[model samples]
Target chain A: MTRTSDRERRRDPARIALYVFLLASAAFFLLPVVVVVLNSLKTMDEIRQGSLLALPASPTFDFWRIAWSSACSGIECRGISPGLFNSIKIAVPAVFLSVLVGALNGYALSQWKRPAADRIMLAITFGLFVPYQCMMYPTIVLARTGGLFGTYPGIVLIHVVYGIPYTTLLFRNFYAGLPDELTKAARIEGASFLQTFGHVMLPLSVNMLVVVGVLQFTGIWNDYFLGFIFAGNENAPMTVQLNNLVNNTRGEVAINVNMAATILTALPTLLVYLLSGRYFVRGIAAGAVKG
Target chain B: MTRSKAPARGLSDMPESGFRPDLVAIGFFLVVALVFYGSLLWTGYLSLTNSRLIPSYEIVGFDQFARLVATPRWRTACVNLVILGAFGIAGSLALGTLLAILLDRDVRAEGLLRSIFLHPLALSLVITGLAWRWLLDPVTGIQSVLRGLGWSSFHLDWLADPDTAIYALVVASIWRSSGLVMIIMLAGLRGVDTDIWKAIRLEGIPLWRAYAQIVLPSLKLTIASCIILLMADVVRSYDLVIALTKGGPGFSTDLPAKFAVDHFFGRANIGLASAASVVILGFVASLLVPYLLIQRKGRA
Candidate 1:
């Protein structure tokens, strides 16, 4: 073929436009984030004075310091640090219980293949589809009636119940790919259900356990609704303060504080993600491959 | 406490201590099933009644559903969800495919760019809404900044505008979900055979044409799965909307999941809420049934 003339090249303007369109689309995707970072480094006066694209003359660290140590969330002056502990308190136990339960259920269903296992799994799978909002009223009612309302135990148990499906689904499919021969051999030697699982299965599931742990941790820690509902005033998680800071922003709306609070609220979870991203990718890939 | 005895957790599951196969375990699973299904049954019953703050024994008999149907907010939510869902799924898929294709081109620093895009995935995506809220809110955000900067003509306040708030949510959700879509499509693209590309190029097909004709059509299964996942996600989307707008500017951005939540929590109208939830569940089941049945029929 002959080399294309300038007219022919120019005739493909739509193709060039596609590139521009895509670049604009990508920019759209990043716009809010760009606004966040830009506003973060701006002084309050500068933020109040101009376009988000404008740079601050003297960008101050003051907003971040206030957000971390002193930004008021309700009527209180203390920041979200206490709520951070509360999230850990709720999330850690919740993760432990849910993962243990989900793993046990997954192992039993997949390996044991008990009668009605398929139906049972289907029903639970359906449970995952149930709008969590639908369950919220009942959960709150149950919590209140059980005298567990606005308590740590209530929040933890709520997380466990809601979390059962995600963890169980991941592990069930994962354990399905495990070698059945090991469990079979253990059973043939008269090893019982608990022993076979404890010895033959659990040791081989370290990577899976970490993945499950990270997922549950993210879900629970990131949660705002359950935390808001059940944690009450004293036990509210970091997101609660994070919410109030953004929503109210003291008397006037403080853009810098909002960004700082967001960064602070997201820090722990982000740190976990950065540290665990490799393992998480590997785990999900392994699970998907097995499926 | 009495049952806490260390009698036997052994592999053999000795008969005396109630092994895994014992009736106790069976009873345990039954209890779990009962509790799981029991609440749902109760919810269904509540939907048929006039329960508000507390559950009443009175049966109102589909009144809530009727009311829910006539409610303007419900209609808006349903419509808003469709719009948001369509834009979100299409936008994410397009971005994901483009990113995957570009990254697959033996590009340098592909991992770094991929990670930057996917880093948003790492953080709890609740922040997506919050971050966007900061960017879009009229008073403290970009629009205000632009106004102060002598570009007083700038008008971009989607988060607070009743008409455009849903699109704001769409933007945030697409940001949060694009990485997952990219990963999925990348996997699909990598699975394509290179021989076809070589063959197509030899036949004078441009790379773009080859991708469109060969690679794109082959990605149908991935696209289908992504669509289904996105549908379910939109149906279940509560947190981001709740964080950003709280279904406000007078419920313009209200989604069904949020509708169900506000009734269930803030409003304390369980009967109305449960009825709405049942409607959603029914819609899901209907969609699922046709596919599964048609698939079964096709197989048969």
Candidate 2:
């Protein structure tokens, strides 16, 4: 019994140490966002010469307003709001289409078996590694050939194509874990191919749908390289606005506005994550374990 | 409830009477594969020819490859990639693991903490880069702040200094990457069997010891995968470099991706870009092969 209390005493310090170390570590991770948020409140003059940890002298919101409205992204000075809207337009449709198609493909692949199934799956697996850069020129060539270049549909198509591999992988794993009997029962009830997918497979896939949505949402939304190269200057996304904001800002740097623009560019995904952290985490866990 | 509904289910042992057309699915797969793969093949072919602006029939026979290999900036990019890969992966893993461990202890508002750690993963490098530029600007950022706090002699101009720009890029990148590692590590943590903790309690094993010896080793696959993803990010990091520095401070922090982009579009040197891309692809493929083998082993 004496030994047991001694062990208890030992465990006591260990738990305390764990808590201490972990809290300190959490603080470290929180620093950057804290810095970004704080910086957004100060003026350029204040930010340029102020301590990183210190609150703004007047705690103004001018930088936030300017970064959202009047900031230059290259030669234009429309701020990052235009790009934010483009991201929304690109993201909403891309998510719905990609996720819908992905669910269908995953359901079919997981439920059906044939020589072609493996071949299709293998082709997509390889697609994941093809590296978009290699495909960029040809996509352009194909786009121009097809008279689709510099168009909204053309860029959305690119997102959908690239989005398939990740989304398919997500839904495939999810459907694999679903009960085969549900599908079997539906077929016995005279359910057609489309009906089985719509009523049986998709209904049970809410968790995975959330997973696919968040991934695609973050991906198509935050995408910079593809959007830069393909979306054209007219349809450039939020990143492009932020890029313009960063690139064209001349000397005597406007640090406050820059920080605010950065914040604005990241706001949508940040807002979504804020609202749906659980769904995102749940989706990730589902995808990772299955992946 | 499901068991009760089971018998009401209309399922049958007999297979469906007709073959599903599945043509739409098949066509979708074929079309995407052809386009994506066809482009890659074209890139490979283009890399081998003496072409500029468009595909050409003139065969260069590795001249572009030879020129690419001989270029100092290209060599520097290769070296820089390795350094960024190692440091960025290592740094993020360490920082993320620490955050994961901290957040695992039933922290108050664990959800909020987790979100904070993950916010960076969803953000584009364009914004993150711009933000960091503001934070790191020598005349206007923290340096000036420090100097204003009256350390007039302090020198913190790494972003401006050619000697240290790559490292500065690594620092901003770590901020972008470590959150992913944290989330991944947290998932790995949740998978740790409760019985292991029971065993540790029975044996009176130190928490740190159990974590280091057992938990850390168990996370080898997670760590490896995180490393590979971070490495890939560093390798393919073009936008971040473009937004952050634009290969500036005298092109000190140039990367292969940026080099490829500049040659392909900016400089209109398609042959050089293709050659450079082919090299980068080869390196990526090699790294991936071993990593895949490791993953396959873990599967077994």
Candidate 3:
């Protein structure tokens, strides 16, 4: 007992050092977020006069109000409200359509033993790595030709198209893991392809759907490049609007308002992460490992 | 639950009379082909032309490619991509692995610490950049804050200095991405066989040596996955640059993706942008094809 206690005493300093290091690293990760949040609450005067690390002397929601409703993003005095609506409008349909199509495609690919399935899967995997810039010009031309460029449907379609690789991957891997007897049973019941998917497969995919949907929602909401290119001035998403608002160099910079807008723009994904932490981590792991 | 009630069908027994699911898969395949492959071919063709403002499609015999190499900014962008990829991948992987190992120990508040580390991954890169940019701004950010705290000689203006600005980008990116690497590595660590730990303990192996020699080598696939993912992020990085520095202090922080976008939209040099895009595609393909081949071989 004395020997073991002596060994434990010897190890105490190392254990303390490990905890110290972990805590410091955690602080490093949290610092930027803490600063952003603290500054977002401070008045411009307080921000300029005081240190960034200090607590706000006089906290207010005025900057958030301005960022949400009235701060100028580019030429428009209207703030991120319009863009917020546009993001929701775009993300809802895009997530639904991408997830739905992915479910269908994944179900088909996994259950069917067709010769083309592997090749198609290979193509989709290739799609995952192809930089968006590579496909941007042609997609622009295609969207313009289809009269879909700068329109709501156009942006949604683009998200779905780009999102296909990830969503299909998640669902395909998931469906592949289930017992083969599930699909066999569905087929034996004389269910049509759509029927089997709707009644048998999709019902079983609620957890995966949540995972994929949450991921897609976060991605679509946080997207700036796609929205900048495709959403046009009238239909720009919150991310694009936030950039315009913060980066606009014409007027005096509103640092507080920028921080406020930054927080607001990040709120949805943050909320999703907070609520669905388990699914989010799982989705990320699944997506990363497979991809 | 009812799976046992139905007769098990052979793997080859695809239902024939129903609506064809294969057709749906085929349709998706066509869309992927038209959007992905068709774009690739078209971009490649455009790179050989002298199209400007609009795609002229005159086939100027590699003029755009020649011009792309001649552009100094393109050179800078290419060099910066290498720097970002090398530093960003290495930094994130190292930090992530450290955190993973640290967390692998039975620490209290593991969930809270993991959440803190991983929360940044949930936020957009734009948000990540803006937050970092604010903190790193010398006049109004951490420098000033530190000065206010009586550290009068403190200085951090990397965002504004062209020479050191790319390192600022690297720092912000590592900050944003290392969490992801940590999570991935942590998962890999969890999967390490318990017997290995027991064997190491029995042998009285130093923990660091055990990890470095035995555990890490066994996690080759996990490390490879992390590298590939980080490389993909490096190639596709645009939002972070735009949000943080906007390739600022005279295009010092320019990356290939930003270079392509600027030429295509801001400069209206479609042909040149297409060449740059093709180069980016080539970079991705070079990385991906070999990886894919190896993955296929492994599977086989």
* Root-mean-square deviation of candidate 1: 6.3
Residue-level lDDT of model 3, residues B205-246, one tens digit each, is: 998899999999989888888898899989999999998899
> In candidate 3, which residue ranges exceed 4 Å CA deviation?
A1-11, B1-15, B297-300
By the TM-score metric, which is better: model 1 or model 3? Answer: 3
Off by over 4 Å in 1: A1-34, A282-291, B1-35, B144-154, B194-204, B286-300
lDDT score of residue A37 within candidate 1? 65
**Each prediction's TM-score versus the true structure:** 0.86, 0.90, 0.96
Candidate 1 docks at the CAPRI level of acceptable
**Which scores better on TM-score, 2 or 3?**
3
Q: Rank the candidates by DockQ, best first.
A: 3, 2, 1
Off by over 4 Å in 2: A1-24, A249-253, A286-290, B1-22, B106-108, B147-155
Q: Looking at model 2 chain A, which ten-residue stretch has the lowest summed lDDT?
A: A1-10
Q: lDDT per prediction?
A: 0.73, 0.76, 0.87
The model with the greater lDDT, 1 or 3, is 3
Interface RMSD of 3: 3.2
All DockQ scores: 0.34, 0.41, 0.60
Residue lDDT tens for model 2, B1-300: 012334323332455544252664676687677677777777778888988876786887998999899988888788878878878888888988877887886556777667766777777777677667766778666687778889999887888888787887888888877788888899889888888878877899987898899888988888777776677667788877887788878778888988888788988888888898888777667666756666576667
Write out the backbone clash pairs for model 1. A50-B145, A192-B11, A192-B12, A195-B11
lDDT agreement of model 2 with the native:
0.76
